[model samples]
Target chain A: MINRHKNLREKKGNFWEERLGLRAIINFLRQKKVPLSEHTIWLYTGSLILLFLAVQVITGIVLALYYKPTVAEAHASVRRIMTEIPLGWIIRSVHFWSATGMIATVFVHMISIWLLKSYRRPRELTWMTGVFLLIITLGFGFSGYLLPWDSLSLAATKVGTDIPRVIPLIGGWISKFLRGGEDVGADTLTRFYLFHICLLPLMIFLLIGFHIFLIQKLGISHPLKYEMRGIKVPEIPFWPDFVLREARVWLIALGVLITVAIFFPRSLGPQADLMAPTPAGIKPEWYFLFLFQTLKLFPSQIIFISGETLAILIILLFLGLFFFLPLIDNQPARKKGKIITAISVIIIIYAIAMTIWSLFE
Target chain B: MKFKYSCLSRRRFLSWLGGGWLATFVCSLIYPLFKAITPPYREPDEVVLLIKEVIELQPNSVKYFSWGIKPGILKRNDDGQLIAFVGVCTHLDCNVQYLPEKRKFFCACHEGWYDENGLNIAGPPPKPLRRLFVYEESDHLIIRREEKA
Candidate 1:
């Protein structure tokens, strides 16, 4: 019986091999090895992010099946999905939690890569691609937030999209393009819906593919200290060993996601009344709280320039520097790298403190 | 202490467990997609307000009514004739409030304004408020979508 089962499997495998030449790819996967170290756990976050992205894509498709992107029907449709559609609440909740999970993992992945100084030497492009991916993921979150057309989302989107208007030349145009007009209305809803579903997904897919290709081309980075000490790290094959470990991590992440989604399903706010006063103490999504707080810290005006414009310019400058971090810190074992690492730590702490402070306020 | 099961080794058991989870996961993904794609039947677009509801609307005054998912304004002109307009701003669809004293409609959002006849008058309103065809039946006032000429 076992022999028959094995023969059947081999026959099916051969049939596919004959048609599509998957052998070379399989062999490549078999040859790939992951360096196991004390920091190996951080490597799991990369795949965890991929897993959550898969979840987001699947659940988002399910949501788009029922979501109506219009001023009148958007809120009502979300309500219906929550209350009427079979198991739709679960799908929507999963999508929500998956987005949150994905963004969180991206932050972790980026931070770990930064702290480990893995973006040193030839891995600069990989780090840059990863940063771009993070930005695109945030864009996905921001765009998706407004799709529900609830009062909170409406208000938050109004504030969020207005941030870009602080730039000097194209700011107004950027805001206009984002809103599709002067205000967040039906056009904004349709535009954000298109962005969340189509443009961002397309960009992320291409970028993620390229990012993975680069990661493959230049294998995963080892810790700077490990390299400096010349400590040989043990390696395991990617085909079965690392893949199995990664699969286990994915299972745990999935379990947590499901539990959270099921327990604290997202609730729909009342439909947005465009003319009604903005809700008091309105807040953006948790991931944006730090930026939100920072924006709030600036007064209306500062010297000659508007506080907001200054804040936005400063943020943009930092972001530009962050993107080119690999070029900035050329030596991983030197004083410059230590300073950059200290700066990164300070930024993380500031972000966390700001997020907490914003939550309280 | 070393006894092994004849039907299920550790490898076979683990594979079975993984396969079971994989099957469950795939089904979970498929179930929501299947349930969501089958479109829900929606009610036909029709809203009729009873005449008595708006009968008390004084001349040169406006009363609010539900026009499907949107709001509508039923205005009684100084001539005591009834005209209805969709209470949504043309500039950027906000609920417009009628000012009986001013005999005009005001959109708080973007400060858009429309005249008593729903014509764009001031502020950022580029076009007039949408006018609905108001038909008086024996007992009801039916508001229908305006036909483009």
Candidate 2:
């Protein structure tokens, strides 16, 4: 009887082990923490991104239940949710505000690493993966903007899709593919919906997995001062130090988001009327406001090519430079230089100028 | 061992308590703020319309009139009896305009068509025209603005 009891206890232990997988992972993390590295900070950042992504996905799915894809019904359905469905406006507000907040957080996270010179040798792949993630984040915003099918969304989409039309050889084809037709209509909404909810999401998931994997493989980048110490600093455990800090940041973010959602829920405007002339002062989401305003500054025509074409060329050149930035600065500098500083300053000025122009002009 | 592990530092406990309180306070503040921004709900009310005395609604003619922010149209048929219908089309709720020459209420949205009696004649409308309660009062036509049964 005693022998039988011992076997039963062993079986119970195995069952418990399978059920507490997180505990096992946490134990492993605890064991792996090095003594002197700032692993805690990177872990916190990663955790916060994960938490925000969770919020985005959950709120997005809820909003999707009531969202209509057709232009005719889309605006009405959104309005219905605001007025009829219980807490629907709050859900939508959370999704919208969270999306904007996530983009801001990701940008800050990227710039912080860059300023800290953490994107150095042996971490180029990490930086590249991050850039890809940034692209996907922007993709999320662009596709999401059209779901409401408001007049502003419609006009912005028209201006946005035109950017690809300026590509030298395949610009027109790219624009056509993106718009799914010659003009913005049901087809455009369907295509954007698919990209936003399906294709880009899959790509983002894969890239995020790869990003985390690369980070783990390379280990957290040590502070600049620690690089010359000959001995690598040991990392702290992710649990109590990192996760706890992350929870605080997340709580703060949630507080701010809820406040914004409550005070300023997403706007609903007059339903989109295609036959009606486009309204004045139509602008894209704040993130794209700068680009929208940029397109407006160009003259109606540019050297026989349309003004839109010239604008597209300029944007493409800018994107090309952005993607190839690592290759441009071949020097092994630890801090900012004249060239880097100049580029950074120019970008800041451009962003500010476009924002101001969007508001005034 | 579990008891020892469960115990938190005083500093950590204080911070957690402070954070929790702050979050609750902010959440409470937000609830009222959301209520303040939402538009006040107004009950749909009955509208009394004067059919003949106020407007010239002729035979085979339709006249659009507003009833307390809700628009309704009065149409006089060949028999000279006035028939009233909500101006908003059943399809996507765009206001329909009476094309006097065409003798039909035409919705610009997707080219929806409704006849003289406001019946859905063409397009993707799933239902017929929504009729309002109409009665002649004091030599005038009045329409109750409640939703059609």
Candidate 3:
């Protein structure tokens, strides 16, 4: 059977294949190989992210059909979808869970790449694009959260938008722009709905397309340490072997998503009242917990600069460093590279610790 | 005696079963997706209103209400008669505004116009504004889809 499949291209004057010349693309995929190692499992995380994203897009479209962008009807519309529309709760639940899954997978993929030092010299652009994609994914989460127009969502968005106000010169303008006014009200809902359903999707789609294209063109990166030591990595064809393994992973993920969505569906809170005081324990989504906690830990003022401003500046500094990391540690075999990796590990630990503390508090 | 079914090997059978399971799983999602995408049925056959809401409505003026998800208008004709209209434009679905000076229902969307009597008189409106029968009782008014015979 294997031999017959191998001889297919050589033997056939297949009509469609001849006309379209898809043979080149097919041959490229067949020739493309993935490095088989203990760390190969991390490579599968990208495909998992893709799977969750596809789930998000499909469910999101179905949701938008029922969702109302206006402040007057957004909450009521969501309620109607939950209680009145058939299986609407399931669709919404899946959308929410899939978003969580996608963001989680994205974090895993990035951290694994960092640990393996796969974002070295030739793959700098790949790492940059990955960081951009991460930001876009988070943006999707943040914007989508406000669409429900529940008290919790409104309060969280209020705090989230205010974070930008701590920036230096353009801070006030940025905050106003994000909120579409001085407050998180009617215009904010309209703006967030636009971002969630249209702008963010377009940006993510284009970036994901380019990100995948870069990945395929450069081929999968080998572990930096392994490459430096001249180790021969075992490999398997991406077309059949790697693809079949990924398909199994996708099936398992889908099953888990459906089960969790059904059993632990997200619940909507009371409709947001602009005149009401913010509900207590107001927190952003889980992904933003660490940052939220970090911001909370800062004092009201820090000498000349405000505490929140200082914190935001520091966060921005770290983000800049993270984006330009490949250039900083251009040579992964050096002592500087080891130090950078160690710092990244510490950052991860800090983030986890902060997230847990915030959850408890 | 041992008998073997050559046409159905155990490996092939299991593969077929796996494929069938996957196919079934995919097919199961279709109904929920269809239900979600296809909006709920909400054709408003009639709506009821308090007479006091429109009691002070002046002639050549319009009072707005909701007909299901669409805008509705209750206008008092100059001759002291009440007329109700589904305020959506016939060309598209933009809400029509009553221009008192012109005394015509105007859709800002495409400059579509309907006469005071709800007749399509100008612009892109292919049909007249939908008229609903308004019935006045003791203290309430009922707007129905059918006109009085």
The CAPRI classification for model 1 reads as: acceptable
Which window of 10 residues has the lowest lDDT sum in candidate 1 chain A? Answer: A218-227
Taking every candidate in turn, the Cα RMSD to the unseen true structure, in Å, is 14.0, 11.0, 7.0
lDDT against the true structure, each candidate: 0.90, 0.75, 0.91
Full ranking by TM-score = 3, 1, 2
By DockQ: ranked, best first: 3, 1, 2
Off by over 4 Å in 2: A1-11, A18-24, A31-45, A228-234, A297-308, A334-338, B1-149
DockQ of each: 0.34, 0.04, 0.48
Interface RMSD of each: 1.7, 8.1, 1.1
Residue-wise C-alpha lDDT for candidate 2, range A16-41, written one tens digit per residue: 67776677777866655533554335
Identify the candidate with maximal DockQ. 3
Quote each prediction's TM-score.
Answer: 0.75, 0.67, 0.79
In model 1, the number of clashes is 0
Q: Candidate 3: which pairs clash?
A: none
Q: What share of the reference contacts survives in each candidate?
A: 0.54, 0.00, 0.62
Per-residue error (Å), model 1, residue B92 = 43
lDDT of 1 by residue, A1-361 (tens): 9999999999887997879999898788888889998999999999999999999988888888889999989999998889888888998999999999999999999999989989999999999998899999999999999999989999999998888988989999999999999988899999999999999999999999999999889887877887999988888888889999999899899889999999999989988999999988888999999998998999999999999999999999999999999999998799988998999999999999999999997
